[model samples]
Target: MLNRLSIRSIFLPTLVGVALLASVGCQEVPVTGRNAINLVDDQDISKKAAEEFASIKKMQRASRNPAQIRIVEQIGRRLSKTVFWDVPHADWEFAVFHAPGVMNAFAMPGGKVGVFSGLIDFCENEDQLASVIAHEIAHVAARHTHEKYSQGWMLKPLGAATSIGIGTTIGGTGIYVPSVGSTAGGGVTAITQSAFDRGKELEADHIGLIYMAKAGYDPRQSLRLLQRMEEDIASKGGPTANGWLANHPSFPQRQIRINELMDEAMSHYEKGEVSRTHTVIE
Candidate 1:
């Protein structure tokens, strides 16, 4: 559907949002306190995310498994409590959706978290599950989704302009393009997207490791989970499932970096830690 839309239609609003960013300045991400190019307001993004989350709940069937619900809620309750004071007016809700073969999960803005049964089944233990939850929560805490909106408004349209120019030069069709030109433009878009996603994945891993540790999960378990993912990728000859793993850094490289953060994350752990007990469904 979006493919049918004109490039200008997509880019113009984005250009306006970029200008708005210049006038309003940026927002600092919580925990990291890093200033991110926040073109859209955080509260607005949070509201939108909550709306989307509600829509998802409406469309998808939630898991009725008591154990699934209990485990997800327990871990979510623990991890979310750590940042409750720092995040005000936060309405945190956690749910497990029963979407067979949908290997996906997310912690949207406004603290709405959802776990897919497929992901829980795929995970060997609660540690791996926590790894996914913590990473997603870090995405929320660092405002990665908001940064993406800002980046989209500022960069994507400009990238489209560049694509048009490239198309014009190669096919003399101006903003219009031949199939070859379309392919070339898509290639540029893919490269730029991959580059941006790399940094976000690294940041999520760093922040998430700390969150999981503070929540009484072992930081080293994050590494074990990543290694398991690497094995999955190896077995499949590449990252097979889409979305989360699509642009994530190669498991080997990501695990290497996560390993470097072990000491810092482990410092938060104690000899005996309380963590949710999970028995993988399948």
Candidate 2:
């Protein structure tokens, strides 16, 4: 059995190693200017994202509506150009998936964006749709996926260390402790991860609002979209924003944040060249 000195020796090196990795992995997130750790290679993540996007396209039905396709592509093209410098290596592609009643959109690394038909239909105007797309694109630009992978990589060793520490502390007492540390570590990890994810979602909103404004869409539409979504959720008896495990911030929280950033976003909008006129989606 490893003694206290042996455990200390291992723990100290592990911590030093983690610090070294963190030092090397830190990068600035675009728009938000926040330092983020991204140890994974972008090319590798992009390649995997492309493959996964392809698989999703096969599983989900693609929308055939010409107008839906047209608007998505149009807004996507504008947003892509706006974010080009931030995502310089992106090979952007946008597709609209036919999933009625499912209001969601997503962006993967390397600029793979998918918008659901329900989301498109729910949007009051083209600008609101642009808000959603811009938010997803912001996720890619901010390298959130890469950061998430890097976090997972770092968490594994920390979790192991926690288990070791717990075992060492209680093993001598001869009480049951096999799952104790692991359970506690896992709960802590989950809460930490959830908080991290929620923060990322808000960061994405911040970045995306700027992206939409720079792309000539009205940034205020994003707030309106969130309000509408919140009302719809309440009407349907869906989950509230207070859930501890939620990965995204509550709509009200998001709106508040967006409101705080509105002036800056509006400045960009005032200076940005208009790319397209508003179109009502029927």
Candidate 3:
């Protein structure tokens, strides 16, 4: 015989049990040992990425040199295949912008990669370029952009609406917030953004080296690339308030971390799982 109070208690517990089961049935991230909250579909990001890439191609001056474009794509394809074989139809596209002054490369979501020609001037050889590509690939594989978006969203409206779950979101779609602290207060300042950027760079380096070795590139290239970046920074005498170099860890500290991570990366290499292909850019 169940009274109204007893029935109510049983119903509440049953409802909670169903919700717990639903939440626990989410996906898991590989290697990172983290559960995922992927309410936003990967296809959505991929579609957005393809559209944005189309516009980028229209606006940006692509490298006119066929040899250079081929080399960059060749390296990019090798690295992409090595890291993301599980995702066969990833739609990875690599483009080299003819901008000589902007020594930068970014891996956008859904496998769109951009390499500014200036980065080529900075990197002396393929190994160095491999290092950059590995780092960017790490950012993609790690799903850092999605993590960032989830972090902000989970903290904002979702936190108010739902309980804080262990795996809030790994990859998801949401309106971009201008700053991590956009609604709460003033946007993340240049100083704070610099610090955050440095942290991301370090994470990228640590994970990127593993990626390089995993793809059969010598892990030591990671260290060499940091050293060269350091020298380039010194050549400028001091950091500018508004530039890529200013938005990262001081070259010295970054160099040290790169060296430290090299040994560990070498261990992963010794396992001999990575595939290798070497071809001349010219």
Candidate 4:
């Protein structure tokens, strides 16, 4: 039978390691001020993202429409200026992909933003497009990719520790324990990671609202754009809210959260010079 000293020997170092990791990796997310773990090297992540962004640009067909290019670049320049200090390492570049039916946009680390032609066509005005761009930029600004990697690093060790503890505790007993710790740890990890991703998406929406407002886009357009998207999803029979397993919060839930932050975003919008004109996408 293992003594109390044996348990201490196993756990003490693990506890200390976790504490050291948290202390060294903790960082406050910009705009939201939430403490997040980000252990990945910034330069490495940026370099990889830049490389991937280049690959995507080469593989995907670029939009040849001058109007699409013009609007995206215009909004990109304005939002990039507003977020300069938040993402200092960003070499901001926006590209429009020629996919006319895929309503999506993405932003990578080091400030590579891409908009599918469908998303541009889907937007009713410049402000709506700006809202989506700002949301993607918020993901980069929040360092979510780095945070996700850090979380994976932490979780693997934690799961292994749980398995070890279970094995050690039952070692002397004649009872057969069937890897219960690993199974339970896996379940917990999946649930926790999904919840974390949902929280990050909501946080991005919050940060993006303020960003678009600061960049002179009407903050209310963000709400309108979400409402429209929600309606579209419902019309197409897409799941509105996928409960705990979904990475993104439902459209209605996002709108509700953004509604709470409208007053603050509107104040920023009122103070900013309204230079972003509504460009109707034809």
Best by TM-score: 2
Q: What is the C-alpha lDDT of each candidate?
A: 0.64, 0.73, 0.59, 0.72
Where does the lowest 10-residue lDDT sum fall in candidate 2? 168-177
Give the candidate number with the greatest lDDT.
2
Better of 1 and 3 by TM-score: 1
lDDT of 2 by residue, 1-282 (tens): 999988876676557547847676688999999998876678977887777678667766889999999999999989999999999999999988776655666677888887777788889999999998898888889988777666555655544423321111110100001111343322222212232367888898899999999999999999988888777766755653223325567778889999999999999999968656678887
Report RMSD (Å) for each prediction in the order shown. 10.8, 10.6, 9.2, 11.2
Model 1 residue runs over 4 Å out of place are: 1-19, 31-33, 155-196, 240-245, 271-282
Q: Give the Å shift of residue 127 in candidate 1.
A: 2.2
Clashes of 4: 0
Name every residue pair that clashes in candidate 1. Answer: none
- For candidate 1, the lDDT comes to 0.64
Give the higher-lDDT candidate: 3 or 4: 4
Ranking by lDDT: 2, 4, 1, 3
Clashes of each: 0, 0, 0, 0
Each candidate structure's TM-score, on Cα atoms with residue i matched to residue i, is 0.73, 0.80, 0.70, 0.78
Mark the 10 consecutive residues where model 1 has the least summed lDDT. 168-177
